[model samples]
Target: MTSTPPHQSVLDKPFVLDLFAGPGGLDVAGHRLGIPSLGIEWDKQACLTRYAAGLETLHADVSAVRRDSFESLPPEINVLAGGPPCQTYSVAGRGAGRQALEDVKGYIKRLMAGESDAEIDKKLMRLSDPRTALVLEPLRYAIQATRSPNRGHRPYDVIVLEQVPAVEALWERYAEVLQDTGLPDGTKYNVVVDVLKTETYGVPQTRSRAVLIARREGLGDAPSLPDPTHRAYEAKEWNRRNGGIAAAPVTQQTLYDVDAPEPRRRPTEDARLEHWTSMGDALAEPVGIKHRGRKAPFLVRSNYGSSGIPGRRGVRTDRQPATTVTGRISRFVVFEHLGHDVVCEGPRFSMNEAGMLQSFPPDYPWSGTAQAQQVGNAVPPLFGAHLLSAALGLPAPAAEAMREPWVPAAEEQRAKLRSHGCGAADGCTARCPRPV
Candidate 1:
């Protein structure tokens, strides 16, 4: 008799269906928590990475599944999670989605009013970018699963959605509709919507995302956002107002040793939370140099503009959290911070170091082209765990678990790559396995 794997055997009810699931970031969190999940991604490269990571995935466009009203989905799925494409909505890209925000809201009203899909698609195609309409796909799935007779009429117990900060208004619209249109069983959804700082959740990168969570009212108390377990990054105060220059070498003092006077704490400041994690904390072993038996700090210089100022690159000491990891990661340069005003340029961050900063495992099997872009697009698994725990009404994982090293399922493959001294960075021409 053959035995089932641990992840498959533990798959009972409350499965998650993730849409636009690039590289399975949220799915990784679900797997670690013993929850079953399947992701649907249109990108072949992302699908390759997902398969390599042993994640369940449907290699197809989300619109294809929407045509069947999600009839192909597993009946046991009771949770809906998605992070839709944010290119048009992001500040780095053209402001197509941002400009069409009002039109998108109008489309939501149309969806709520029982408009036909053909009619909606026709109107959506006229927008600046048709992909912007995908932001509404989650609502379409939710409506089908809950109200459509063709589907099994199984209502999702919890719904979670996240996107760029520009999508906050859209999520607010989601909250209003989800609450107004209660479940078929007469129980409304209790919803919460807000922008969350990833650094506060122990991600060693400073990034923010808009999040919306809704739970069926009859299940229990209303869902709430997870309390931050780490302090928020205060760059100005921490930098001692040095005009964005490093105050001192990282090896000499702790991250909190600032020369400036202490500023008043914000309302969200909690005495119990720990200090925000820094790049030194996340990439100490891989990126730090050995100096007199102790780890020495480094500097990362951004070629892009700092805070919307063109041509002014940003520099951060390893003692501070890394700036938002973006698709343009090649533009970042690393330098060894030699004491007494000496500096030496070094190799850029390896794939492992970049992923580690984003709270992914150091050994995560990144496959396909543009791996850095995949890492940048993913939700930090550590942050997702806290969000999932809150939405499911489960006890949060221990804070220490965030720092625990993770070994990917495909250890043999990783071992082979390490043997070849291939660090999986750009310009590497290793004969490693690519997705077939």
Candidate 2:
């Protein structure tokens, strides 16, 4: 279990419960922003990861959770958050077919009704209660919930949803639900759907996530959306939407382009440049394998570019924001090392990097194999710190490096290396053999 810090007091102490909380990404963010959280996940490794992050977690299937049991806890649980498994709604998953939709619908019904049958109670936990406000994610579940017979009839005070562009239709449904369940006179609601990237908020990777926040009547003028504080762009079309005297558009350069006076175009041979351009590579330490076939299953293409795989040199750029980092790096972005123009034939984003880009603290522990650790995961606490800080009208606290054995030894080693005039290639340009 991760040890809690001494002499450090949590900020607001808003009690939160995370359902399907993978490695406590959301919980970490909440805590960094002053809210205390508990996580519920069935995967033992994921549960351990969350526990290591100093969160109290329940290692049980979400379907088996007893609402009556949670309701039994004090009413201090101000926020309830979770993303039901996305595979059901995933564009690639069972095609969101009738069976898939019905299965999820059944879950939503249990979520809102707080009712549990013998069969479902044996497998899942329900979240449909008034005391513990719900903040559902991925947009798909939220949209479906709004359309059910329980429309506008929910117990929570706020509903925040997020997803990819392909799921925007879900947001429209959320909007309609809000209209149908018109708020009481004094209650207010906000529906924000836009492209928000991790880099703009200080994460190193260039990941754009579409966020939708719906405020119930009581949560104080739905937390104001965090305004963009930084900027960069990919090409002319990248900023076609932002004209009139804007700063540089948020691009790969914003995070990686340090010390360079202007945006520099790197030729294909510069592996370092390619790594920086590839969000996945930037977060990953190369695995010493040449491009053979597809490396990971979750391969994503954002744009078009040239390739060098014999006759298969196809150019694809990842302009669109990535789907969730499912801990499967191969599922996020593509990579190419064929000495020709680099092609992202595999997923480029790693779950770890994506989590960091999502504001997870640098030290948050990830579970499962390396691939699972990289893609399918949580937005780091660091990312949540920015958003939560804004919501609570407080300054984000400085991150305290964890003093675990795994980390301190690395710090000591780096210090030793620094004394000998030897450091990683990225740092020691003059003294080291390779500069880059």
Candidate 3:
């Protein structure tokens, strides 16, 4: 019989309003760190998943949520966080640049106008209007109304936003609009967390995302991106257990195959071998091309070319960690490859496994179809917890003791550096250091 895993939250004990809160990736992350977070998502299925995981969630359009709606609940909201949809500005879709920002601003402007403002309310009610514009409306409303010196209330202490790298530049506008709302002119609001990832934090899959952390000036410093607890890049003195400045690199092997459940043995070795071989060939050769030598594995499976190879030739793979997981895609069929070659393909990752790769707790219950699982699309819970913790000026949870592969190489290098007496206490040089 299999043993159940222990239960513990990932982030601080409580935060406010998981905006754009699809399937509560942010909420799960906050929970993992012991942080309490409420979620607001339009999708009912997504909200159900959050509710199942013990989160306070609202199934409603975020834009339509009014500051007045929660006025009776509490006077303080610790954090405001979410990743608004990015397809409007994603590379794959139409690059809806500044216009998208304008639409978002318009939404907030509409929300800020009271119901008494019949003209503005009518325009906001237009069904043809883009709802994405309303995504940030509540934030803008809270920002404007909450800033009066004696208003007897405070908005969220910190505003945390996440999106694709392409949206990095838009933060400037986000900051500007936020400031226009109630924040003081000099309010040091807006911190761009450039490097956030599940893989870097030991989630196995390397999912990169940018998180924007902003807070009122007097409320302490803006959230700092958590130091990588686990290294995805190899460094000479980085140790997994030792808490220090130097971090170690995470390996691909550690991310993919580690902690995975045993695969279902096919009826015959020939079948299994053939499956492995085919996947091996795909990994060896870039996707889209047939290899001559190795008999491609016997796995007869359908393949979909999602990420187009540049050359449309030889094997390829993406060196950087993969984009967010859509879930439901077969594992053996490589959606992303190195250049054109498939990497490792065997069985489709289980929902729980994908969630782990995305940094969700092993037992976090996620409701919905594989497409709606939100495993890959959501931010890793660990990374989210760290960011939320930093925003709230709370201490990070103690990291679990785990074996790290890079430790050996790092130790070997550290030993050589120690003899020279040139190594810092942690043996890390700000820039890449070469031993003399």
Q: Which candidate is the best by lDDT?
A: 1
- Per-residue alpha-carbon lDDT of model 1 for 51-138, expressed as tens digits? 6676776666688777853675777788899999999999888989999999999999888877888999889989989889999998
Clash number by candidate, in order: 0, 49, 51
TM-score for each model: 0.83, 0.53, 0.59
lDDT of each structure? 0.73, 0.41, 0.47
Q: Which residue pairs show collisions in model 1?
A: none
- Cα RMSD for candidates in order: 7.1, 14.7, 18.9
lDDT score of residue 224 within candidate 3: 70
Model 3 scores what on Cα lDDT? Answer: 0.47
Task: Please give the RMSD of candidate 1 to the true structure.
Answer: 7.1
lDDT of 2 by residue, 236-302 (tens): 4333432311133223332222222323443533332221223332234322122222222122332
By lDDT, the candidates rank as 1, 3, 2
Scored by lDDT, model 1 comes in at 0.73
* Residue 322 displacement in candidate 2 (angstroms): 10
